[model samples]
Target: MSRITLENIHKTFGKVKALDGVSIDVKDKEFFVLFGPAGAGKTTILNCIAGIAMPEEGVVKFDGEIINLVETAKRNVAMVFENYALYPQMTVYDNMASPLRSDLYRQNEDVIKERVYAAAKMMKMENLLERLPSQLSNGQKQRVAMGRALVRTPNVFLMDEPLAHLDAKLRNAMRTELKEMQANFGTTSIYVTHDFMEAMSLGDRIAIVNQGKIVQIGTPDDIYYLACNEFVAQLMGDPEINILSGLLRKNGDNYSFLSNGSEFVLPADAALMNKLAAYDGKSVDIGIRPQHVMYSFSKDAGYRDYQVYSYESIGNKSVIEAYPAGHSGRGDTHTHVRMIAPNGLTIKIDQLIYIDFKLDHTMFFDGSSKEFIGCYNEAGIRALSAGKEEA
Candidate 1:
């Protein structure tokens, strides 16, 4: 396998900018992921790498040599699309064997059978080898599509939302199987998906794309706890992170944030206080995951009591939407604070409940620039740009 690199790539579709100066260095045999929302140019990147779509600017390289001019057939890369893209008239076995029978591979019948069956076995589709695509279930069809790619011994594997269309159960099963299969082959791969499940569970490192640009690249832990901006923080979680706006205050070395007239005294750290000093008396947004917020039936010593505005039952847990005790509301979407509680907990709308911030888990972002600035964690206060796990 070879290391893959894209340098400052640019591409356009008519008047639309599909990729704007995108660059990434995928290590040899690393399961790297391209993760972002729709229209983020994830597929365009895969096409460029496979020679299906060429960039108007920038270099594509295999190891240290440029492959910008290489033909698609010569690239030795296999791709599995979100659509199965299988032949309707061909049996499962025949479809799986098509690549081997192509001009470049040209494997004999016995070898084709050997490869196809092995792939079918890996996908647990050997029993359906004689059936056509229409005769099999949707999940079965998807497995065949994956089997087609698995039978090939390509230098790289490119997958674009391969499990996007499957039902939740099937998606979970396939996701687990795919991770195990990747481990077995140890093939260099670049997988693209909008789903965090795939990105977090599968990638050794994930590149989060947005509006045709690579915004941030890091391990799942880094991206979740040390997000670069408001966009990344909101995109990485389900039900979304709990975001609150407040006034920042600094009196000498003491620092605290005033949200809805109540003050939250943040632990002091010289370096972090220095960075936040600029925003004193100004409004900034703070974010913490719902799980990190704890609620008590009554007011605790240092915690504030809030009034529950709404609540929803979600499986074994409940999400409670609340506001500060005296708060009327703030205009725009940042009006309410959300908390998570156990399923059986007694709670209701308009009820007053006490809340506390696990400061060690809270994140602060600049209100205007929308970029992550610092956080209050177990290690006291630290800036996110420092990129070190709080000890």
Candidate 2:
């Protein structure tokens, strides 16, 4: 296992900067994921580590030893790219055996046969050994690429969306297999992907990158429950998070959030109250996940009437977006709120629904900077970020 570190790395391509002052420390045998949208420098970071793309500035180290000038072949890092870089002329077995047969990591036929069969079995591609790249599907080719990297006992594994081409069911299956393989091999790994579920499921820790800068580095729980900003929170969750512009107003001895002519009581968490004390009578953005917003056909106490803007199914569950009463939930409007609903729910656009936000789960951010301020469980999330486990 190896500990990889990048310090103040900066890379630019003539006019555009691909990475800007990025630094990360991946622990030994840890599965670290770099997650961001396309063109967000996720792949650039991987290339810097694999020696495929050298940063114009900063140091790259393995086990505390600087290796900025090391050649790719000498790094002993196995990389599986999303494009499935297999030799079209070679059969599946040959492609997987190519790494082991190379001069840097050459093995005899006896050992090669053992490793090839083991990798093929684990990837469930044993039946496709004799098939060439042209004879296999995209998903099959991706598996072969992953198997090729998996056969080697490299110092670290660098996987750049290895499962990107697979179908949904196959993608999920391969994700589980990859997780198990990482655990069994105990290899330090750096994975790059734009999929939130994949990053949360496979990574021991994840780094959120955006516009060439590292936004936040933390465990999945630290990220999901305590995102440092509105961008990170929206990127980490599906259906996106609801960011409502509002003012924290003092209500007698307590405080409440006022937004769009509606009011909701804030939780009595002492820490959260203390943080919001400064924001009282000023604008703030309260982030509430879809799961925290509830909707009912019938009016319930504390629920405000909203016009259903859209209701669409996303597999087993559906997302219902509602606009505050009288507003046209149309183009250029960003005031609608989204909530989760069961699939097959009988609903129609423009239907009136009553919804309420779960104030206890609300996350507050600065209105101007969009930076995180506090949340209901601020203490608990801070503990988790500090590497403490809850009892």
Candidate 3:
């Protein structure tokens, strides 16, 4: 395994800038993930590492040595792409053995057979080794692609959404297998995926990329709890985080958030209160995750009235999307918020309900910049970020 570094990398294609001043230090034997929406340059970073696409500026290094000018074969990097780049006419075993048969990294037949079977077993495709790529399902073909890469002892493993084509159940299973494989192999790996769950579960450290730039880099806990900005907070959660437009006000030795015709008393944590003092009497965006917003079917004392906009089932749980009482659900204000509810709840459009914000779980962001200011558990989150850096 090798420590990989890309410093001040800049890559452009005509008018589009794919990577802009991107720098990252992937520790030796670490599983680092690049996470972002599509068209956000995740794949470009992989291509740059593989030597398939050279950066216009900056250097790519392996174990502290420059490898930017090195040929692809010399780089010794195994890449598993999203498209399952397998040979149509070759059997699974042949496809995996092809890498070892190549002149650049050739091995004897016995060695090739042993490595191929081992990889196939790890991928749970040992029985399918003799089947041609054309005779396999999309998921099976993707596994073959990964198996082929696993047969090589490369300096680093670059996987670009390797399980993107698998069904949800299979994807979940493969995710577990991949995590175990990484731990057992102890190989330096860079994985790119837009799935937040995969990023959180598989990566030792995750770098959030957006518009060809690094937004934040930290462990899953750091990113989920201490998001650098609104964009990142929304990306890391399901049902999306509610960005409530509100004002910060001092109410006699306490801070309160005013939003959507209601006032929520901010938690009296000393750390959060002290940091919020600077934004007094100013607008701020309060981030409330769906799970933190509570709902009551009937009228309640502290809960405010809302009309149901939509209710959709997600697996075993459901999300209730609601808007203010009078506003049209169609392109109105930003008061619309989502809350997680039980799957069997009987709900209807425009049904009246009461909801309350859990101020203790809210995150504050600057109104203008839309960047994170602080949250209720500011000190704990800061400690987590600091600990990750130290590690």
Candidate 4:
């Protein structure tokens, strides 16, 4: 096992900055995932560590030793690219054992055959070892590529979207297999992917990178529940987090929220009030995950009024679209709010609906800066009170 670290890394391609001062630490035997949209510099970071691409600035270190000067083969790192990059003319047996031929340790034919078969068994490709790459399925070829990487027993494994070509069912199956492989080997692994589900499921720690800079690094729970910024909050969730525009204003001894001529009183939290007070009469953005929005049949309940606009049933759950009452002029536009409910729930399109805006589940951000103001709940209230008392 090995620990890999990138320090103040910057890579430029002509006028385009591929990586801008990106830094991250992958602990020994840790499965770290680099996640973001395309062109976000994830591959650049992996390349730097693999000695495939050198950054104009910054250092790549392995176990406390700088290895930027080392060649790709000497770095003892294994990389699986998105394309798999297998030799079409080579048989699966030869493909899996190809790396062994160039490895520093000399192995006899029997040893190579043993290792190749073992890797093939792990990937469920043992039966197809003699098939040429062109004759295999996409999933089969990917497994062959993975077997090649596994046969080397390198210090670190860098996988860049290795499962991108598989079907949904096969992709899910591979996810489970990949996690098991990582656990059994206990090798330090850095995986890069644009898929949020894969990152959330596979990584011990995830780094959300953009424009070459790491925006946040944390466990899946932390990144999901306590995003460091608006971009992180917006990027990590499915159906996307809903961003509602509103205003913060002082109302007597408390704070009030105003949006599109609608207003609501905020809970008493000196700290929270103080935080909002800074943005008095100014626009702010509030984020609410679909799961946080609750629907009820009762009109007198503690919830605002809305009208269901549409319904989309996606297997296990239903996504209902709604618009706040009296703001129809906001015009079938930004008024659309999505709510996720169990499959059996009885809801109709264009029906009157009531939603409890579980304020405790909301996140506030400064509209101008797009930075997190506070995450809802008692801790946010406490932090707000602490900030107020300090003032």
Q: Which residue runs of candidate 1 sit more than 4 Å off their true CA positions? A: 251-254, 268-282, 326-332, 376-391
Q: What range of 10 consecutive residues in model 4 has the weakest lDDT sum?
A: 382-391
TM-scores, all models, native as reference: 0.90, 0.95, 0.96, 0.88
Runs off by more than 4 Å, candidate 2: 382-391
Best by lDDT: 3
Q: TM-score of the candidate numbered 4?
A: 0.88
Name the lDDT of candidate 2.
0.90
Write down the lDDT that model 3 would get: 0.91
Q: Could you give the candidate ranking by lDDT, starting with the highest? A: 3, 2, 1, 4
User: Candidate 1 vs. truth: CA RMSD?
Assistant: 3.3
Candidate 4 lDDT (Cα, 0 to 1): 0.83
Q: How close is candidate 3 to the true structure, as a TM-score?
A: 0.96
Q: For candidate 2, what is the total of clashing residue pairs?
A: 0
Clashes of each: 1, 0, 0, 3
Poorest lDDT segment (10 consecutive residues) of candidate 1:
382-391
Model 1 per-residue lDDT tens digits across residues 1-391: 8799999999999999999999999988888999999999999999999999999999999887899999999999989989899999999999999999999988999999999999998888889999999998878888899899888888788999999989888987889888877776667899999998889888888999999999999877768877889899988886689887888988657778887677888877666677788899888888889888888886689878788887888776788878877666344337677878777767767789888888667888988788998765524222442343221
* Candidate 3 residue lDDT tens string, 1-391: 8999999999999999999999999999998999999999999999999999999999999999999999888999999999998888888899999999999999999999999988888888999999989999887888899889989999999999988878889898888877777666668999999999899999889999999999999888889998999999999989899999989999877898888778988768888888889999999999989999999988888899999999999999999999988889889747798999999888999989899888899888999999989888777877876786576
